[model samples]
Target: MTSTSARPRLAAGQTTDKDIASFLAHTEPVDALAQDGYLAGHDGRAIAQQLRRPGLVRALTFSVCHSARPDTDRFYQDDEEEAAQWRRRRTQTIRDHCAVCPVRAACAELALRDEDVHGVRGGLPEEKLALRLATDADRLGKARAADDRVERLRSVRLDAEREVHRVALMHTGGSVPAAKRAENNDEVRTAVQERDAAKKAHRTENGWTVAA
Candidate 1:
């Protein structure tokens, strides 16, 4: 008896731009394929599912970025004079690699989903990607929500500091015992870090900073 795989087969000439886009719509972000963002123990199931989808295999099989430089940070350089040189190189990459890629549509869809935060994806640079996302109503709503969370976290941080101070003042020596002081300090530190993280998240939602 012969055993067969259950994966659906890709139809001939079915890897059109629309097909690629539709395939990516059902898949996760392709950040796992990036240079700086590669993780060792990523959820393989997602990738397996992507491969089993319509056009992902054909779209990425010979894509150019795969053979380009592994260090993707240059794609997100600041717009200084020095960075202009890198920008030119980035433009060349878009022209030479991304422009001719068969998966450009899929890559663009990923970028539109806010997946390609650090560099060029779908032939659009980080700046262009941010501008596009900024115009998206869904992205705007999420950014506003992030801003509110940052404000709330800031208030919690301030309250934590006051509590730390109050606890310290409860002692006649104008400070809590060593053990209690350490605990209070930890609480304040955690609160401050949480606020800072929230601020970072707000920046990410607005595309002001690269998501780590």
Candidate 2:
């Protein structure tokens, strides 16, 4: 039997920019950064989701110093550079909160899925790299686990291979044989490793650290 994921479902909506600006301006912040004079997660999503429905990302989000980053719209508290540096460190504060956050994966999927998320969002530049690296590492781990299972079932590899074949044929609307599965496994492993290596190269080019 197939099992369903219990994770919260993504919803569709068309929140507008005006609605967002009004939302932020009118509603008071309720998150940790509230005392520091900043909007929270939903606030960030409220603005992004106004343009895209899946814009609801829950990263450790907060504003930075007006001077340190140089593009900040306004000051967080004081005009001092020290205050800005304190604001800069707020990124780590968000990540520390994310360590305990229940929906970290869902939050990250939202950001990565969105192509326009530049600058600081949930965490700092490097902190976001860490989150994304952790995510990629997790997915790769699942793939590796599947590989390990096939290795351990060396004797009954045919049986497991047959199941995979049946499922693939059913999805592809074609015939397939477990007897031919051994060759297919080798091909799949090659393709996966190549793709993974390419991605790693790209990550390195951009200076984003990928996990092992």
Off by over 4 Å in 2: 1-84, 119-212
lDDT by candidate, in order shown: 0.49, 0.39
Give the clash count for each candidate.
Answer: 0, 1
| CA deviation > 4 Å runs, candidate 1 | 1-58, 67-81, 138-212
Error of 2 at 171 (Å): 39
Find the number of clashing residue pairs for candidate 1.
0
Model 2 clash pairs are: 60-122
For residue 113, what is the lDDT in candidate 1? 44
**Candidate 1 residues 139-193, lDDT tens each?**
4455345545655655665666666566545544545588877776776666666
> What TM-score would each prediction reach against the true structure?
0.35, 0.23
- RMSD values for the candidates in order, in angstroms, are 14.1, 17.3
